[model samples]
Target: MLGQGLVDVFFEDGLNWEADLLEDTRFVMVETTAYFEAYRHVLKGLQEIEEGQFPFEKYIIACENEVSPPKYLRNRRTVQFDLRPLVDENIVIREDEALRRQRRIVNYQFSAESRCAESVEILNLRSWPRPDQLHLDQSQYEALQTALTKEFVVTQGPPGTGKTYVGLKIVKALLHNASIWNSGHQSPMLIVCYTNHALDQFLEGIDSFFKGNIIRVGGRAGEDMAKHSLKVKKQALRKLQDMRQIAGVRFNCTKSMMEVKLEIERSGAQMEASEREILHEDMLRPFMDNCYDQMTCVELPQQQEIPSMMVEWLGLEQMLGETQVAVQQGREDDNLHDKQEDEIALSKRICNASVRLSTVTTKFVNPTIVLTTMPVHESSLLTSSNTTSVECHGQQ
Candidate 1:
């Protein structure tokens, strides 16, 4: 009777499978013998699933089975399937673990013998140093002290509470202690932020004090100021810089002064006055002589005589002739100015441009503090040393 029942269930499952297969538009009906032959051809149609394309349902199924499904099935449309059993099993396990953790936390909280409990009793919170430099409030000072002494501390407050400020002080104190403990060796510190904007703000706040000791990873906006960022590693940045230099040089050599002046004027509103001045002084003036030294340098096709009516309406006849005369006159005195000042300014810009790329490439050579959006605890920079990691998050 049991064997007959098992056979009935097997047939029922097969019929359900057949119905599902038929419902799916991707599958077609075939004779049982022909199906085996078609399978070989169908397998050839399978393509590898790209990363991040896996559906939520398929992910859950994969997790439940504890095995990866075939690549072809990964992209298939999800069917209505009951996941209650797997979900229930996970919920039960998690609930039990939560209960266990709750009991542990309760014991730790109430037990007089616990180290944290003992610290609260013996430590004089009032005696904690209030550094004049940090200008911490009473609440922030208490929070800082607790964080420094305890293994785990939760500091919570509403917005604009100086949480980040106090946390940075705590980090500074810990770094000083670590350096002493490690016999004058600078200790590595990893600072994690919730967002790239926060990371930039934090780095900017401490940049003067830390100077070359800080390295920032991720985000393109902070690249130039932070000295280190992941954007520096991209080949595109290097290429763009090279192209800019080439274009600057080419614009000086190829284009006439009148044409260049018109181009600059058209885009002048978008550029800073200082930047416009630099372009005129460093790039345009130096190359102006080369541009107009030879009349043959004009690359444009010869224009026919302009109509009197159009020239009067446009007022281009005088402007165009005057621009040519100015260029010729300016070429005479081009060699009279000092080239040293321009060279110095150009060198400074080049140095500033390469700083981020150089810093990111050589960051691991020394013990340094890193500011990043996520914790890079597994990085060799942290793992190789006795590093202290501090995570700070807030609305500010």
Candidate 2:
């Protein structure tokens, strides 16, 4: 039985299936949550298409061309892929609702008022680093610029034309302008790749530029990325905070013991209770002060003055920055150790370009800008499917 669902299996020719299953045999099943979500999204998209309510009205497919097969095949035909967009007036696209929905998405995604003209102007006015200093060649620069300014952009390039490189630049630019473009709401960006390796590589690249919260939904991350993973980071931070809390409790316990002693002194033999209580408190003060000095970790400010949760958050933020720096340093060391001469030279070139870019794009690469605007507490990104080109999950 799989969960609550059951199925019956039949053996052929009286074969003993149990005999084939050894005592040490094991079965591993993977969750299909991502696949199921994709499937459900595809069904919704198809339903919308059937109802003539699909978006992207301009790209609707028209008629298909069929041709007979060659002499080698008997009574066979194939559909030619010379497909064209439907432009007939008879085929009307219902776009009013789609437009409204798109507007809402734009507003939420940008955290702005959805002023396209203003946004375009903002993109245009950006003082990008000098083309000569950027790592990208002319074509790459043009592609990156077009992607930044246009509402819809499709970049086509040959294999070695730095598509991924330009993509990383675009991500950086968008993250930098997250607050300015959205005015106040900084929507998270979603990146989808075909394989886990590609995703890990892309995320690692993001980590190089931005030191903020990152939650990787799926698994099979590389060993080097363990500290960067969401689960590991959270656990490490929580463990540190727990230690601090325990220390605080121990210190509080010491104080409480002193208070109990003073109370006992006040309840002394009826003659000199008040004077004894005063003497007891005075004597305990020095020892309590020593205890406070020893338990320095617990000498936190009062909660009313400085909340414990805020302290934990500040500690986490500082650690995250240090972690990113360490990760970057480790990467640099690894490159120095393992890189060939050509790779080392190329890396130097990229570093020079990055330094130049930083002069003009410092605001965009600032971690504070991205973290303050982007709601990391929410589900940041929803990746699409691998098999088909259909957009999958929406913002949660």
Candidate 3:
């Protein structure tokens, strides 16, 4: 179970507890905020312990960051913590009832995230090819470590059947169709293939983009990353205004500044207890103005609910768009053999990567077990008793 609470106290340092790990410890992942508090509390508590006061149990903390998924290499259920909650309320715990009473500050990120602990999604592809949705007979991804997911299935097909070329198309289909995490801005899907040859081919199919198309996302994934790359970005700002209903700090900004505003507002990061100076009304006003002028219309989507994963799809489109257009033009400009030439090197690379993922989908799709038989005489198989089960192939 995910342990959450305002840190009434904390413990850290290499764990000194002596217990059978598999039986006693449960796997734990804590947020970054929780991490800081746990460390600080433990450090302080340990110092206090050395001074002959705080309890001894709080000293041995072998805490790891939230990203480190605990492994049971030797059957130890580990605990990880994120102390993001303690950013501003550390020393001031006396005022807050949850902190005073030592209640776990179980926020939405913790609660929502706890439900997805075991079945996290991971990607395994390495490249892309043209016409990404090209269908194979299926079974190409049977060997990839991360490709085998109970939540999803992998398919394999031969070169003409579209195994490599179909990566981006599949991603787009999933983004538009199956995704439950359909945030308007979140479009980060990847189309990895085993070979650069396949990569080039995949690129050839997707880039036939006409000008002035918003949905033809190919290369703009980085824009979203740039827009939101922050130590903190806020979501659910309305909730904070409710939290601050009593102590109203006057603030306003144009619609343009709303992105940055939403980020900070969404974070709800309390800083009152920190050494840093808090933002006064006047000081924060100009920041909004600057952000307003800097904000672009393209950055503001009509859909706020879009997932960032969508951005990757868009980027993939733009990248593939450019590539597909080039391929079409190349076929027009050069000899027909150019397509084969482009594929030869990549086909070889796929051969090597096939230890984990195959290049030719046919190898995967066809059954490995063979039924052996000798060639029989055509006359014996097609005797007059067959009564001419005639099939017509009429031609002019």
Top lDDT model: 2
Worst 10-residue lDDT window, candidate 1: 86-95
Off by over 4 Å in 2: 1-122, 125-130, 182-186, 237-255, 268-396
C-alpha TM-score for every candidate: 0.27, 0.38, 0.17
C-alpha root-mean-square deviation, each candidate: 38.3, 42.2, 42.3
By TM-score, the best candidate is 2
Show the lowest summed lDDT stretch of 10 residues, model 2.
80-89
Model 3 TM: 0.17
lDDT computed for candidate 3: 0.36
lDDT of 3 by residue, 177-215 (tens): 222333233544445544545444454433321011122
Q: Residue 348, candidate 2: how far off, in angstroms?
A: 99
Candidate 3, superposed: residue stretches over 4 Å from native: 1-152, 157-159, 165-168, 209-396
Q: What are the Cα lDDT values of the candidates?
A: 0.47, 0.52, 0.36
